[model samples]
Target: MLKWLRPLVLLLLIGLLGIFGLRWTQQNMRNAIPSANSRVSPIILVPGSSATQERFDAMVNELNNKTKTTSSLLKVTVHTDNHLSYSGTFEPGRSHPYIVIAFENNDDGYSNIKKQAAWFNHAMTILSTRYHFNHFSAIGHSNGGLVLTRYLEKYFNQQKMRINTLMTIASPYNFSETNIDKRTQMLTDLIHDNKKIPSNLVMYSVAGTENYNNDGTVPFASVEAGKYIFQKQAKNYTQITVTGEDTTHHDLPQNGEIVSLIQQYVLHISDTKQRPDVNVRH
Candidate 1:
């Protein structure tokens, strides 16, 4: 008789969990980004395969501190492990320039991009719920770009997550020819499926070379390969290649030169028009 009661109690616990899950989903959806189409979209920075969120601290400072730059139009509020949401305003039309969501992927997504990208999708959901942002712009360094690229392929249209711009810094898309997760071909496949990619999605491949050829870690050719693919996909693919001592693979996110260029060149939100004549082919 006691064993029979156990099943009944287990059923009640399961029902409670289901109800809680549904409540959480509803609240998350309701608080996502607004849909006005004219506000400054949130900017998201995702680090590379083994890096942490601290990688962008210097760059984030540069962006927030710039006095007369396009990137300055947004006030960067980095979301850390302890803090889940911005302490300030998430609204766009007001005093805030832009809300930057810089998060760390605990997994770093080193091995499998598909699984990694799925995790990325979930992170975005949490951000959406927290900030209630309507649209967003994305920046990824190294393999982090692969995760975002795959996420777009699978879930971009599912919830109308408007990604107006995507910027990849020193990412090695074609690192291996025979690896199970052909990171290079993933972008190629994305380009092949360009029609599905939103026209408003402008992608920039920012490559840096420490020496004369490679950016310490990623090859110049690998980053530039997306030039045509973004063009074909109507993502307005732009390739920026910079030669300098400070622009290493790891430093690309924090390099002052590259950061200034991005501020003047790639960053285009409702407040600022796209800066012109920087190797853009769209």
Candidate 2:
């Protein structure tokens, strides 16, 4: 009689439950993963030796003055104990947040740079996990650039988070050695690991020159030696020697011309002025 109808009803009920269960699981999964629009693309900056997370405050203020909207600044310090301390907040709906990472042991030297790179990797891992960003831009000044180079060579994984652009300001790739022929141990190591740098990366190596041959701190040849590391590996390696007021090694970070370059290249702002001496290396 109606026995066949009961069996059909039971099958329909079971099918409905399975469909609902699947939808619930999918909804939860979607909730767990951050959407593309919700994710931030921060410009992570590493300061030079003896500098702290507050190193870029003045520069950032100037950057914000040029922008229509003000960006959030987040400073993070990685301690020797592997702990992290943070200051500042990320404003909602802001895609281009500025993040500065400074190490507790912010000293100069090859060994310290290596340690800084390792610390940077750890900090970046935590940052990526917390913020859910899949891409970022990088800027490093002086020894900070060396740390970033080491990190890229050893720890950076493109599959995890893509590096959009890299700008190294007044970085002494040859470490105070003015002669390009006399490469330092650090330079040699960096060149040897050049292949590890992302092929599609657009890198800008900035050399600040107060005089014709040097930046007052880093020699012109020392900074120019970045060509050996990035020229073949990167998609576009540009060597820009910025000469004007405040072109010294430390002041280069806050130079007006450098600010313009950052706006044009790193921030992707249009109609920015470029200096005449900007050289593009193949």
What tens digits encode model 1's per-residue C-alpha lDDT throughout 195-280? 66666677888888887768778777667666545666744778888876688788788787777765755453133565776895
lDDT of 1 at 265: 50
Model 2's TM-score against the true structure: 0.82
Name the candidate that leads on lDDT: 2
Error of 1 at 104 (Å): 6.9
Q: What shift in Å separates residue 161 of candidate 1 from its native position after superposition?
A: 2.2
lDDT of each: 0.64, 0.88
The positional error of residue 68 in candidate 1, measured at the CA in angstroms, is 6.7
Off by over 4 Å in 2: 1-38, 271-282
